[model samples]
Target: MTLYNNVFETVRMIEKEKLDIRTITMGISLMDCIDSSGDKSRQRIYDKITGYAQNLVKVGDQIEMEYGIPIINKRIAVTPISLIASASGEDNYLEFAKTLDKAAKEVGVNFIGGFSALVQKGFANGDRILIDSIPQALSETERVCSSVNIASTKAGINMDAVKLMGKIVKDTAYLTRDRDSLGCAKLVIFANAVDDNPFMAGAFHGVGEPEVVVNVGVSGPGVVKCAMEKVKGEPLHVVAENIKKTAFKITRAGQLIGNEVSNRLGVPFGILDLSLAPTPEIGDSVARILEEMGLEACGTHGTTAALAMLNDAVKKGGIMASSSVGGLSGAFIPVSEDEGMISAVQNGALTFDKLEAMTSVCSVGLDMIAVPGDTKESTISAIIADEAAIGVINNKTTAVRIIPVHGKDVGDTAEFGGLLGYMPIMALNKFSSEAFINRGGRIPAPIHSFKN
Candidate 1:
């Protein structure tokens, strides 16, 4: 009866709540694909990715059908292209991006990541080339997503990369202006970026990772919010306990799906990322989970404290349920992706500064936010710098996926469509960070980061 009750409850969670496997990402290493000839290298990359991930989407669909679990996306993450393409001595990496896009389409994955460079401390030869190509690469490719790690806890922050990324972001927005700067939505700027993350646009197969592996991302924000409602008048400790238990259940389901997918593909199962990633749908929100914890609104005065508790509880529960828990394993608070977050921003309950504070506890940083079209590049860089500092000092991964939608402003909304959703343009400080950003150099690692 106990086993029967658990199975019944899980089924109910999937049916009534928006419980789902967010993505089953196949991480493919491209190190062996490198060649002296750029054409040859691209061909190798194309063959390797399509070959490894060809059965990925099909396997994901099969699992969803068999287990009655919703698998929202089937995706792929590859080794950073900078390392792979540098061997070819290519001045431009545009072809590399196109090859990835083509391969992703061939395999039918929703998104293909790792058009990336890791320059947390400084730029390598290939890192600069890849960074230079990002504007055109993202603007030209349909499925290719890009990321640049400009800061880390040990290596500190690369102010040069930070400053350059500001311009790169603006250029991407301008190039994709026909689609409301949709290209910027596919780009992420990071600090302490992890390798095994199954979610994009920050997902990449790290050098240390196995040649081919399967990573899973699971989400159940609506299930969590529903659980919170059950203990409406409960104490904070009680609320925390309930969240932990719910997270354990969610993570278990994710691991089951992940292991099955890995087995079917004949690849090792990687970590299960149990992030409570939200969608545009109502009742599916991290903000609502926080609000259900007795807050008047999502971004009220005690929001950060609530978020800290929630993040900690979720991690604790996930760790208990799965030994292979990795990736960004906490709650994600992307404004465009969460209906509750969008409502909070529109009602003036959430502000840009509050979002920054929230990132200190949440999974990622300043994700899927759309700022005014006229916002200055230096100001955007400054925003990245601030988020980087938080991640570096705290030794946690943080990323910025802000989009400055072309011809849009505070009173307007930018429609990105699908899971990318839509968001109102949020206001930013008019004060300039130009002079600060112009003082380009690396910010030294924190004192704590010096420990061996």
Candidate 2:
């Protein structure tokens, strides 16, 4: 009887509250595809991805139809190209990115991640090549996404990589300026980036993951907000409890779908990422969820505390529903992706500094934010450094995915359409961090990271 009731409740959530699985990401390891010859390596990479993910879209659609649930995206994350391209002694890794894009298009997936380099401590040969190639690689490819990790709790922050990534990001913006610099939208800079994340543009198969696996990212900001509406004027504890209960139901649905997909595909189930990923659609906003918790608007004085509670309750609920809960399992506060966030920024209620504070507790950091076209590269590096410092000190994952839309400024809108959404250019500090960023050295690991 309880199971039946739960099913009915889930159906209601889907029907009226916009609950759905955000992504069904297949993580395919490409370690064995490495070859000294770049052409051979890229060919093998393309073959493996296309072969493994050929039926990904069809299977996702089938599952959606059978269960009467919506799967918003079918995507793929491969082992970071830096590792594979290094074996080929490739100076330019654009061919590898093209291969990933080709494989994704062949399989009909929306995006393919892991054109990445891990340089949290220092740059290796492959890391340098991949990092240098990111602007061209991303500019030339449609479905390929790229990331570079410049900081981690264990190894500390690599200032050199941070500085370089700033220039890379600016260059990418210029390369794709014709398209509102959409290429920067597909790039992420991370501190302690996870391997099994199903969300892009940060998803990548970790070095320790299985050869092939299925990971799912479930989202329900609308559901949570609707649940909160039912308990209006309730005590804060009661509100927290309601959010937890709603999260449990959302996560259970994700686990069910993940298990079925993994079984059908004959691949191991990786993890259920219960992130409250929002969209531009009405009612599907993380900012609205916080507003339901009593904020006049997101980025107000109480926003950070409210987000902290919301994030904690979500993790608590999701963990109980799935033992395999991993990746970024909390609320996401992407500025452009959430309608409420976009509104808040436009209304002058949300500022860049406030968003930074909110990210200290949210799942990801400084996501999908847009700045003026002429924003200095050093300033961008400073932003990455600040976000990275937070992640390293707290031992949590944090990232920066800001876009400097070329030829756009404050009060102007940068439109990308679809799930990429649109954003009103926000103001920046307008200060120079060139001296600090130019001091290229590693920041030592925090004392708390010596837990071993």
Q: What would the TM-score be for candidate 1 when compared with the true structure?
A: 0.99
In model 2, which runs have C-alpha deviations exceeding 4 angstroms? 1-7
Q: Model 2: per-residue lDDT, tens digit, 165-194?
A: 999999999999999999999999999999
Ten-residue region with minimum lDDT total, candidate 1: 291-300
Native-to-model Cα distance after best TM-score fit, residue 396 in candidate 2, in Å: 0.4
Off by over 4 Å in 1: none
lDDT of each: 0.94, 0.95
Writing each residue's lDDT as its tens digit, candidate 1 over 22-90 gives 999999999999899999999999999989998999999999999999999999999999999998998
Give residue 349's error in model 1 in angstroms: 0.5
Candidates in order: C-alpha RMSD to true structure: 0.8, 1.0
Residue 406 lDDT in candidate 2: 95
Scored against the true structure, residue 64 in model 2 reaches a CA lDDT of 99
